[model samples]
Target: MVDGAGSIGGELSPVLEVGKSLAAPIWRQFMYLYNYSTNFKRLEKEVKKLKNTRDEVQHKVIAAQRNVEEIKQNVKDWLTDVEKTITEAEQLIQEKANNPQCFKRLCINYKQNKKAFKLKREGIDPLLQKEKEFDQVSFPTIPQDIWLRSSEDYLAFESRTSMVKNVWDALNDENVYMIGVYGMAGLGKTTLVQEAGRKAEKDNLFEDIVFVEVTQNLDIEKVQTKIVEKLSIKFSNETERANKLYERLRSGKKILLILDNIWEDIDLKTIVIPSKMDRGGCKLMFTTRNLDILEKMGSTNNFQLGVLEEEESWNLFRKMAGDVIQTHELNSLPNDVCKECGGLPIIISTIAKALKNKSHPSDWKVALRELRAPSPTKFMGFLEKEYMKMAFKL
Candidate 1:
């Protein structure tokens, strides 16, 4: 370039004029014969390497998806580019191969050579190293509780079976934005709600189903964090989490969010739960012990879970207490114990399981006496709901 420098495009430099005599031979030796022709071969070799590298990346993406992961955007873009480049290269190679090894072939190879060189320098070579960073191509996309289907441990009581159907139907109803499930403590409200979710999932009623646990005390950050974790992203704008969540949910339609064990009414939006959804759009299902709270939270359609009847209660009790209750010495005693449970499945389960290993009648009699107490001192505090004390009454 310095030798070719000139005075304002008027005259060539003196040094360039002196070297001009060698230009033709130099061009034929390097640019025409050695470089262009060899670039085509070089391009072919590099293109094969590119395809092999691309196949490796494609395998990673497929494996990641099978593991329930979301592929990164760049990885997808790279794969798309690989497909395009390979397709174009394949066509160019076929066209150039049809030409004879003459000037015509050189002309054809010229274009293919530049493309192949550009692809290696700008697209393939750099990308091969860059793509290595994407070996772990995806991330876990589903939330911990997205897998919250009903398990075998779920007591399939008559009332719960019917209520699960009812909840599922209400959520599917177009006008229902939120559905409420309320029952006394220990009525298995959480379990029934999960069963409803299980059914909805089986039927593909929603694109995504997430279960959130909201106890008597609300933790706004904890709630928001749970949602963020499900989305497989981070949002730490302590104050702006709700707004961010609102936008995300608005854009991502058809999500079913189940909030379990709510003690009081809460503004769903405050936790980033969208207030508006399209027809057959996102819906909320919350479980609480209070229908009043559910109504306050805008759940006009509510399902009240009833306690198990005597027979259902007895059956559940027998299942938990096992064959020990069927022994001749303990058989009739189990009936009296079941009655004291007042058809409350949790209480029946608790009392029956407590007596499960007691082979002696004296131990069973002592357990029956404990069930009659104002507060079952041996059981957990949550097991002492007012109804529990009342049910223990003789």
Candidate 2:
């Protein structure tokens, strides 16, 4: 009797183990039906929290941009992950409208409902933690300035490419004190210099770079502030700002200064800009529409950029305007328009983009008329082109 009882007890234990294992999957199957609405509500609430975090971070991003600081990679990564998580969770919510409940059909998909539960723990929670861990949104470094990023690489011609190389080589030349890139307006002077400056910094040619565009209305204080700011220094009163800038440059760091769009000369005495004689590691580069201005600045190496060749101009224009201008009806008119731009990249591109929408021959004639009818604000300010960029889209 005892032996028979032991045998029955052993069989009962395995049967209980089997029953316990089956109960879990059965509960899991019903969980979506029972908790589907609850999980969705929780996920929605979590997403809202995530969005609030994103909003706060976005403000930081804007401030970083305004201050000309680089946004931290981790912060950028977290933001991307948050956006993806919210999108997936929201998609799951939208899918629930036609989805069969977990208990309604034997073969029903629980993936969508399960994601709602999984996302809170898997996606939203991690982002919330990441947000809490962030102490700052940006890091400070001398980044390549505007033109390097915003302008397209049009170093197609060997001439422009050689100019860029010569300029970079000039910076390395020990005897070279101040370098100037001289050309008429819209000749990509700013673009070329900025790219060279970027390469110099990347190759560790310069310890730091400060780039500031000194527009027509030059504010001495504003110029000083911009230079100081790029070096991660605060500009207080004018005297204090100049002193700080001068001292920083005098610190013997190989700092490259690029002053763009200088209409007239700025006094180094007032700004306390140290020369290479004082600090051999420091260098100055400027761009001006007039070669005379470069000469006045005492540029040791003045490089002049020529207008793009006829072929280059058409290629640039076509790239912007597309085949609409290349159609059968508009063959010579396109060439005529390219000639009107006079090999200036800015003019060619702006005219092409503005004319891209206006495929009619009459529209081309109107553009030609505007090009021929000279406006005082046409070249230097690009006022006409600026207007075209906005007007055409309307």
Candidate 3:
């Protein structure tokens, strides 16, 4: 509950003031959230566009492949035809030589046509060489990007732009950057990272993008098989699963792995991080709330997520409320109301939604009073603690 009118206002203003000073480029802070939203919408539009493009490319490549196959078959048939022709020609020449008088007129004509025989041999040799090269060539399959949900309307996340971009750039770098993106519950860390993975895949930054949610109870074998399934590689024997995974991961291609909801420090050796990949760079991105777990994971860097700005928070609250509070009189109290929610987007949105049906000033005051209750952070912390417990069990 938010105490909108009393001591809660005192607490809200100072936190907002301190947060603004602690974070630079205040508006720039929201870049990741805004860019993610924009990119997601663009991707949605391009998905259909790319589908048509892939269909067209597939049709063209298939036609080209078939033509190459047909050429090889034609050469095979021609070779058979030529073999019969050569055998018949040899027999004719032998018979003509043996019976010179019988072949007197024909012998002169056969000698005169030797130039045509040379031309036939020359044409067949080049065609055969071409057929061999065509047989060796294989066309590549068109790549497809996976579709994940967009985060454009997720107003609570509008201020996490820098941290998101840092993670994105780090993942896109040439080294395996193990970066951690952590936040209190419902700050949209998983959603933002997933969207980043989708974007990376679409941009061709990686050959493969994998998403795995690691729960508290760890199963090493299960994780291995899941990765194999995602890559569409087969395992002849379950015993060789780890070996096969190691081999596949080492085969020189950039892979972006998203290990979401990670609570425990994962041993890279057991996961087979493929230290010897022929590919220059690959990445692993993890999301968690526990700082100690991240440190144990040997993170190259860590990002701590904070609450949204007042303006952004209010905007998100308004959007969630929709047409219920259209006029200035109703809207004027939101900043005072929002501040009491401790700048947490989840809390703000939840409260805004609960009061969407109420239009009177007295009702708004009652709602604010509830928010100002002593257990505000604890209320939000309850969900985070449960989720964190579940995430780290692995």
Write one digit per residue (lDDT tens) for candidate 2, span 351-374.
Answer: 787778777888787777777776
Candidate 2 accuracy as lDDT:
0.75
Model 3, TM vs. native: 0.52
List the global CA lDDT of all models: 0.70, 0.75, 0.59
Clashing pairs in 2: none
Q: Write the per-residue lDDT of candidate 1 for residues 1-394, one digit (tens) a residue.
A: 2211222256645544554456776533333332445556766887898889888888888998888789999888888888887787777677768853476455445555556557667766776777777747777665346346447656777656666777777878867788888888767777677877887878888877778787667997798788766655556677566666666666656778888888889977677677754323678888888889988887888988887888898888888789888789876789888887777666776677667787788877766676666653634343344335533211
Among the numbered candidates, top lDDT falls to 2
Ranking by TM-score: 2, 1, 3
Give the winner by lDDT: 1 or 2: 2
**RMSD versus native structure for model 2:** 11.9
